[model samples]
Target: MREARPLPQYLVQRYHGWRATAFVENRVWYRRLADDGQHPRAMVIACCDSRVHVTSIFGADTGEFFIHRNIANLVPPYAPDGEQHGTSAAVEYAVNTLKVAHIVVVGHTNCGGVQGCHAMCSGHAPELEEKSSFVGRWMDILRPGYERVTPLPPEQQIRELERQAVLISLENLMTFPFVKMAVESGNLSLHGVLHDIAEGMLEQYDHQAGGFAPIV
Candidate 1:
């Protein structure tokens, strides 16, 4: 095992990370003290990949948004069952508990899960026999997005697929009871966003236009 080293040189001016209380400091502790009482204005459902951090991308100030992360940021269609449904539960909580005014599903370019799903859609993978593996199943969420973007060229297809996945996840969000209720009551709004890490660009879904437009 690696030995515990002293704090890195970057800690010079900074006494400690947790010691300085940002808006999010001790939030989990607050949650422990029955302070989990829903107050965030937005809920972001995003990918677990390091590159897809919505907090950093959106400049979220911690308590401003509730967040849920998953393998690919895809929300599966509603199905009442005993399956592991943490993402769905978080959505429920944000709508039912936090009563967040907005819900955003963020997807990014060059996502490994998206690439793997694209490969699977192209029928080029050699491991179809054991399709129950983690990535294989995770990519299943992208199946429909893959089909929709098939006609575009390779590069364009990827861009379109990423956009479509965000839309699909947004649609999936509406399938939940709490989300639907919030939408119907005009208390919640849904959005889909695409993050271009390479270009440092963020695009918001223009549902009427049916395409992503730069946020700025």
Candidate 2:
């Protein structure tokens, strides 16, 4: 095993500050949460982008959401091949164990992952095409999305691809038998949304509308 060093001074200081203020201010709530265990009502599958603050965006409090983040917020098709699947594991726990009523897939504008997919699909990103590149393989999940938006202008295609990320994840979530059963039996619902980072706006997917509409 590699020898590990302590946390950087800035992060350590920030943690201390949070411990002193936020933790102290909500000590009772924190303790109660610990004693009761979590009962979050929703499971949020979001991107690993630091700029997208899931809690802040939803104004969520502690234990309000069970969040799973990964590159591009991609959820691969359900495959029960005896292999490690972090995202699938999280989804299974959330739906079957936690019984969350809502599963929300959140994608954001100007997503680097989406951009990389566009580049790779357009045959521009050779580095990401390597078989050994984990990122390349992961972004492959969104290739269909890229293909869907190919006829559009460059800027429009990128924006639509971001929304497609959320849509694709929502579709993949249903590929899980448990998720499909839960939805079919009225125990769970799936949702998709795109967050416009610079504009501070959110557009939700409306099945009836067949596209994303701003959250009024």
Q: What are the lDDT scores of the predictions, listed in order?
A: 0.80, 0.95
lDDT of 1 by residue, 38-79 (tens): 467999988788987677777876478798887668898887
Over 53-74, each residue of candidate 2 has an lDDT whose tens digit, in order, gives: 9999999999999999999999
TM-scores across all candidates? Answer: 0.82, 0.97
Off by over 4 Å in 2: none
- Summing lDDT over every window of 10 consecutive residues in candidate 1, give the lowest-scoring window: 14-23
Flag regions of model 1 displaced more than 4 Å: 1-17, 20-38
TM-score of 1: 0.82
